[model samples]
Target chain A: MSSLEKRLAAEKRFKFYGMFAMTLSLFFVLILMYKIFSTGSGAFVRTTINADVYFDPNFIEVSSNSSKKEIMKASYVDLADQVINQNHPGLDEENFIKVREMYTRKFDYQLRDYIVNNPNVIGKTVNLDISASSDLDQIVKGNYPRNVPEAQRKINDYQLSILDSLDSKGKMSKTFNFWFFTNGDSRDPETAGILGALMGSFYALLICFSFAFPIGLLASVYLEEFVKPGKITDIIEVNINNLAAVPSIVYGLLGLGMLIGVFGMPYQVPLVGGLVLGFMTLPTIIIASRASLRGVPPSIREGALAVGATKMQTVFHHVIPLSLPGTLTGTIIGMAQALGETAPLLLVGMVAFVMEIPGGAFDPATGLPSQIYLWSESAERGFLEKTSAGIMLLLSFLIIMNTVAVLVRRKLEVKW
Target chain B: MVDQNSNYALQTSEVYVHYGKKMAINNVALNFPKNEVTSLIGPSGCGKSTFLRCLNRMNDVIDICNVKGKFLLNGNVDIYSPDIQVETLREKVGMVFQKPNPFPKTIYDNVAYGPKIHGIASSQNELDEIVKDSLHRAGLYEEVKDRMDDIATGLSGGQQQRLCIARAIAIRPEIILMDEPCSALDPIATAKIEDLINELKENYTIIIVTHSMSQASRVSSKTAFFHLGNLVEYGETGKIFTKPDKEQTNDYITGRFG
Candidate 1:
C-alpha cells in the first residue's frame, strides 16, 4: 500500500477501536443498570397482608385528654391478637404462632401510629393492611416458586393455601413501600430503609459544601492573584496538586486520628464525616477553581482596573462573576465524587448500623455508600435487594447534582 | 523635581522601566499640554505604551514591570510617590486600551460602571444623565440611544470601541490616555474616531499612542517619537513631520529604517 493509504487504514482502525471501546463501556453500564433495577425495584414496593384490627376502647384506656405518651404506652399487640383469634377460633397453638409471625415485626408500632393518627377509630373494627414479614414478602414476590414440592418450598402446602385464600379474598396487595423511604436500617429486612443513610449523606454534604466551597475559592484566588510565584507558592501549588491525587481513604484516616482521637468527638457523626470528606474534596475544588480563574482573560481585569476600580473591586466585581459558572461546575462535580466515596467513610466508622434518622450533623450516622456496603455483606437475600436499592438512590442523587451543575453553567456562562 | 510646572497636564522626567533588569523604557522625559491632543508614535515595543502606562501607574499590576520615574500630574504632583493614592491618580488619568474592551454587560451598565465605582453619580437619574452625556461626547449616542439596555459586547467592533471611549469619559477624568485606539478599526471607523478625538480635545487632555504616523498628524498638535526605548524627538506635529530636528527622527519619518 502507498504511504497515504496506510495512514488512512490506520485512521480507520483507530475509529473502529474507539467505537468498540464505547460500545463495550455502554454494554457494561446497561447490564449493571438492568441488574440493579431488577434487584432493587422490589424494594420500592412492598407486600401487605390484610388483617382485621379491632380498636377496643376498653383495651386502650385512652381519654381525649390523655397525653400522646400515655396512649402510646398501651399495648396494641393484644388488640391485633384478639382480631386473629376471633377469625380462626378453632386454630391450634402452633398454627396460631405461625400466623402471628406472618405480620411485620413492627406491627405493634404500625398499629399504634394508626390509632394516634385517628383517635376516633376507637370501638371500631378497621380493615388494616399491615406489612408482611420479609419471608412472606419473598414468597409473595415469587422468589419462592410454588411449583416446587412441599419439602423443597419456603411456604408449605398448608401455608400456600392460606396465602392463596388471602389473595382470593383481595386481602393480599403490593403497594408502594412508603416505609422503605421513611424508616432507617433494621435487622428485620421487612422494615429496613434508606432514610438514616440518606439523612447522613445530606448532613455530611451540607457541611462539606458550606465549608469547602468558600475555602476552596479563597485559596484559589489567593494563590492565583495575591501570591506570586516563589518558594512558598511553589510548595503550596505542588502540595495542592498532590492532594488531589492522594488516596481519599487517607483523608478518613486523618479524620480518625485528628477528629475522633484528638478532638474526642463521637465516632461516625456526620459532622466529622463531612469534615473528612471536605478535606478530601478541597484539593479537587481548588484545582477546579484555579482552572476556572485561569480561564478568565486578563483583559477583563485590566478593563476593570482602568475604570479607577480598586484591586479588590476589579477582582470581585469583574473577574469573579466571569469565572463563577466554571467554578460552580467544578465544585458540584467534586461534591458528587465525594458523595460516592465509601473507603474513607469506613475509616471514619460510617459503616455502623444506624436505625434512627440523624437530627443534626453531630448525630451518629451512616451515609448511602456505607449503608450499601453494610447491606451487601449480609447473608440474607433481602439485604441484596436493599443494597441494590441503595446504589440506585446514590446514583440518582449524583445524576441530579450533575444536572444542576450543568444547568447552572448554561445559565451563567458568558461568551466573552 | 527640576523646575517642574504645575500647569501642563502631564510631565515625565528620567523615567525608566525594567522587566527584571532588562530596560524597556530608558530615561525619558515628555510633556502633555492640557486641553490639547498629543500623540506618541513609535514602532512596536519602543516603550511608548510603557511610558503612557507610568502616567497612571498601570504598570503596577505587572509583578516584574518595575517603574522608576518622576511622573508629574499638572506638572508638579509626584504621581509615583507612596503617599499618593493610586485610585485617585487613576481616576484623574483614564486610559483606553489598544483593544476595545466593553464589559459583558448592557451598554448602559458599561457606561455607568465608571461613575458607579468612583461614586461620581448620586442617583438613578444622575447616572442616566452621565451615561447619555458620555456617549454623546464619544459620538456614539444617536446609534445606541434607543437600545441602551442591549449588551455592549454584542455591538459592532467600531461601536464597541466608541462605547469604551464613552465609559472612560463617564468618570470625567482630566486626561484621557488612549493607546492605539484606532489600531483595531477599519478605515471608516478610524476616520470616525479621529473626528471624535478632535472634538474630545476641547475638554480633555488627550495623550494618544499611535503607530500610524498619519493618524498622529491628523489628530495631534504635539508629537513625541520613541525609538529603542528612548524619546527620539518631541515637537509640534507640523514641524516634526515636515522638518524633524534629529537625523534618526527624519530617518524613521522618511521610512529609511524603523
Candidate 2:
C-alpha cells in the first residue's frame, strides 16, 4: 500500500479509538444519572394515609386565650390513640401495635399543631394527613416487592398486612414530601431531610467563597504582578501546583489536628469545615486565577499606564474587570469541589448527625456529602433510598453552581 | 502657549538606555522646537521607538530597563527629577502606539478615559463635551459621531488608530509622541493620518518615529536620523533629505544600507 493510504488508515483507527472512548464515557455518565434519578425520585413523593382525627373537647383543653407555650406543652398523643382505636374496631393488641407502627412518630405533633394553629377547630373532625412509616411507605410506593414472601422481605408479616389493609381501603395517598426538604437528620430515615445538611453546606461554601475568593485572587495578583521571578517564586509556584493535587483527606486531618484539637474550634461546625475546605480549595483558586491573570495581554496594561493611570488604578479598573469572569468561574469550581468533598469533612467531624439546622457558622452541622456518607453506613434498610436521595441533592447543587459559572462566563467575559 | 517662536518644548542631553547591560539607546542629545513637528527616522532596531518612549517614561514599566538622561520640559522643568511623578510626566506628554490600541470600551469612553482618570471633567455634560472636542480634533468625529457608543475595537483599523489619537489628545498634553502610528495602516489610511498630523502640529508639538523617509520629509520640520542606537544626523528635513551630513544616514535614506 502507498504510504499515504497507510497513514490514512492509521488516522482512521486513532479517530475510532477517540470516538469509542468518548462514547464509553458518555454512556457511563448517562447510566449513572439515570440510576440516581430513578432511585431518588421516589423519595420526594411520600405515601400518606388520611386519619379521621376527631378532636374531642375534653382531650384538648386549648382555649382561645391559652398561650402558645401552654398549648404546646400539653400532651395530645392520647387523641391520636383514640382515633386509631376508634377506626380499627376488631384489632387485637398485637395487631394494634402493627397498626400503630403504620403511622409516623410525629403524628401526634401534627394533630397538636393543627389544633394550636386553628383554635376554632375544637370538637370538629379534622382529617389530618398522617405520613405512613417508612416500611409501609416503601410497600405503598412499590419499593417493597409484593411477589417476595414474608420470610424473605425486610417488612414483617404483620406490617405487610397493615400496609395491605391501608392500600385496600384506598386511604393511602402519594403526595409531595415537604418534610424531606425541611427536616433535619434522624435515626429514622422516614423523618430525615436535607435542610440541615444543605444549610451546613451553604455556611461552609459561604466561608469558602468569602475567604478563598479574595485571598486566592490577591495571592495570585501579588505573585504574578508584583513579585519578580527567581528561585523563591519558582519554589512558590511549584508548591502551589503541588498543593492543588494534595490528597484532600490530608487537609481534613490537618483541620482535625489544628482547628479542632489545638485551636479548640467546635467539631462539626460549618466554621471548621469551611476553614478546612478553604485550605483545600485555596490552591485551586490561586492556580486558576494566576493562569487567568497571566492570560491578559500586556498591551492592555501598557495602554492603561500610557493614559496616566497608576498601577493600582489600572489593575482595579481594567485588569480586574477583564479577568472577572475567569475568576468567578474558578471560584465556583472551587466551591463545587468543596461541596462534594466528604472524606475531609468526615475527618473534621461534619459526619455527626445534626438534629437542627445550623443557625450560624459555629453551629454543629453536617454537609450533604457527609449526610450521604452517614446514611449509607446506617444499618436501617430504609436508608438505602435516602442515601441515593442525598446524593441527588448534592449533584443538583453542583449542577447549579456550574450552571451559574457558565452563565457568568457567557454574560461577562470580554472578547479581548 | 509660550509666545517664543524658537522656544524648545523638550531637550535631552547625554541620554542613555540599557536593558541589563545591553545598550538600547546610546548617548544622544536632541531638541524638539516648540509648536512644531520633529520626526525620528531609522532602520529596524535603531532605537527610534525607544527614544520616543523615553519622552513619556513608558519604559519604566519594564524592570530591566535602565535610563539615564537629562530631560528638560519647557526649558525649565527637569522631567527626571526625584519628585517628578511619572503620572504627571505622562499627563504632560501623551503617546500613540504602533498598533492601534483602543481600550475595550465605547469610542466615547476611549476618548474620555484619560480625562476621567485625571478628573478633567467634573460632570457628565463636561465629559461628553470633552470627548466630542477631542474626537473632533483627532479627525474622527465626522465618521464616528453617529456611533460613539459602539465599542472602539469594532471600528476599522485606521479609525481605531484615529480613536487612539483622540484618546491621547483628550489628556490635553503639551507634547504628543507617535511611534510609527500609521505603520499598520494602508496607503489611503496613511495619507489621512499624515493630513491629520499636519493639521495637529498647529495646536500641539509632536514627535514621531518612522522608518519611512518620505513620511519624515512630508510631515516634519526637523528630522533626527538614528543608526545603531546613536543619532547620526539632526537637521532641517529639507536639508537632511537633500544634503548629506553622515555617510550612514545617506546610505540608509538611499536604501544602500540599513
Candidate 3:
C-alpha cells in the first residue's frame, strides 16, 4: 500500500480506538449506577409495625406523682409495656414484657405524656406503628440472610416467627419512614436514623459556607484580579496551591490539636467539626474561585477600566458577576467533598454514638460519614444494612451537589 | 509642509522598555500626529507592539516589564507619571488585539460592556443606540444587525475582529491602538478594516502596528520602521516607500533581508 493509504488506515484505526474507549467508559459508568441503585434504593423503605397501643392512665398518674427524674428513668420501659399489652391483650406478662424490651431498652417519656394528657386516649387504642429494631427490620426487608446461625443472630427464630406472623396478619410493612427524619442516633440498629448526623452536617456546612466563602473569594480576587504579581504574591499563590493539595485529614489533626486541645473547644461537636471542615474546604474553594476569576479575559477588565471604572468598582460590579457561576460551581464541589469526608471528623471526635439530634452547633453529634463509619464498626448485623443505607444517603447528597455544580456552570457559561 | 505644533497627540522621548535585565525597546523617541494613522512596521520581535502597549501603559500589567522613559500625551501631560491612574490612561487609549477577543456574549452585550462599565449610557435605549452606532462605525452593523443577540464567537473571524473594534470604539477613546488587527483577517476583510480605519481617522488618532509594508503604505500617513529594538526610520509613508533614506528601510520595503 502507498504511504498515504497507510496513513489513512492508521487514522481510521485511531478513530475506532477512540470510539471503543468511549463505549467502554459508558458501559462501566452504567454498571456502577446500576449497582448503586439496586443496593441503595432498598434503604429508603423500612419495615414497621402497625398496631394500636392504649395509654394506661394509672401508669401515667403513678409516674407523674413520683420524682420527675425517677419518672423519666422508668418512662421507656413503662411505655413499652403499655404498648405491648395494648397490641397483644391476651399474651402472658413475661412475653409481653420481653416484646416491649425488644423495641427499646430505654424509657420513652414522650409516649407516656401523650397517654396522660389526652383523656379520650385512656381506653381508646391509638394507632402506633413504631419502628422495629434494625435486626428484625432487616430480616423483614430481606436484607439479612436467613441461613445465619440462630445463636450468632441478634434476632432469633422465635422473633422471626413473630415477625412473620405479624406480616401474615398485615400488621408489618415497608412504609415511607418518617421516623428516619425524626429520630436520633440509637444503639438499637432498628431505631437509628440520620437525623442527628444530618443536623450536625447542616451546622458544619453552615460554618464552612460562612467562614470559607468570604475569605476564599477575597483571597482569590486579590490573587487573580487585584494584587500586583510580586514575590509576596508569588509566595501566597504557591502556598494556596500547596494547601489545596494537602490531605484533608491533616486539617482534622490541626483542628484536634488547636481547636480542641489548645483552644478548649468542645469535642465531638458540630462547631469544631465545622471549623475543621472549613479549613479543609477553604483551599479548594479558593483555587476554584481563583481559576474562575482568572477565566475572565483581561479585555473585560480593560474595558471596564477604560469606561473610567475604579479598580474596585470594575471588579465588584462587572468581574464578580461574570465569575460568580464559576465560583458557585467550585463552592458546591468543595461542599460535596466536605460532605463525604470521614477521616477529619473522626480525628475531631465527631464519631460519638450520639442518641439525640444536635440542638446547636456546640451540641455533640456525628456527621453523615462519621455516622456511617460508626455504624459499620458496630457488631450488630442490623447496622450493616444501616451502613448501606447511610452510604446511599451520602452518595445521593454528592450527586445532588455535583448536579447543582453542572447546572450552575451551564447557566453561567459565557460563550466567548 | 506639516505644521510643527498642531497639539501633538502623543510624544515619546528616549523611551526604553526592559524585560528583566534584557532591553526590549532601546531609546525610542517618536511622535504620533493627531487624527491621523501612524503605523509601526517591523520584522518579528522588534518591539513595535511593545511600544504600542507603552502608549497606554499596558506594559504595567506585566510583572517583569519595566518602562523608563518620559512619555507625554497631548503635548505637556506626562503619561508615565505616578499620579496618573492606569485605568484612566487606558480609557483615552483603547486597544484592539491581534486576535479578535470579543467577550463570550451577545454582539450587543459585547459592545454595551464598555459603555455600561464606564457609565456612558444611562438607559437601555441609550446603550442600544451606542452599540448600533459603534457597530456601524466599525462596518459590522449591516452584516450582524439581524443577529446582534447571537454570541460574538459565532461570527466569522473578520466579523469578530470588527465587533471587537466596535467594542473598543463604544468607550469613545481619543486614540485607538491596533496591534496587528488585520493579521487574522482575509484580504477582503482586511480591505474593509482599512476603509474603516480611513474613516475613523476623522474622529480618532489611530496607531497601528503591522508587519505588512503594503498595509502600512495603504493606511498610514506617517510610518516608523523599527528593527531589532531600535527605530530605524520615521517619515511620510510615500517617501519611506519610494525615496532612498535608510539602507535597511529601503531593503525592508523592497522585500530584501528584514
* Most TM-score-accurate candidate: 1
Predictions ranked by TM-score, top down? 1, 2, 3
Model 1: lDDT equals 0.88
The residue pairs found clashing in candidate 2 are: none
**Candidate 1 chain B least-lDDT 10 residues:** B1-10
As a whole number from 0 to 100, the lDDT of residue B87 in candidate 3 is 71
Predictions' DockQ, in order: 0.77, 0.72, 0.31
Candidate 3: regions farther than 4 A off? A1-45, A50-52, A55-83, A102-123, A126-130, A138-170, A225-238, A261-264, A290-329, B1-4, B106-109, B115-132, B141-151
lDDT of 2 by residue, A138-230 (tens): 877778787787787766787776666777998778889887899988777677888999999999989888888899999998898878889
Off by over 4 Å in 1: A61-65, A146-157, B1-3, B255-258
Q: Each model's number of backbone clashes?
A: 0, 0, 5
Top lDDT prediction, candidate number: 1
TM-scores for all candidates: the values are: 0.96, 0.95, 0.83
Cα lDDT listed for each candidate: 0.88, 0.87, 0.82
The TM-score of chain B in candidate 1 is 0.97
- TM-score of model 2 relative to the true fold? 0.95
Residue range A1-416, candidate 3, lDDT tens digits: 99999999999999999999999999998887777667655556666677777666555544334554544445445556767776766777666654654454433543654544543455456776666666666677677778889887667776777777887999986777655567788877656788999899989998888888888898899888777778998898899889988888999999999999999998999899988889988999999888888888887766555445677977887688789899989999999999888989999999988998998898998999999899889987667756777787888889999999999999878766
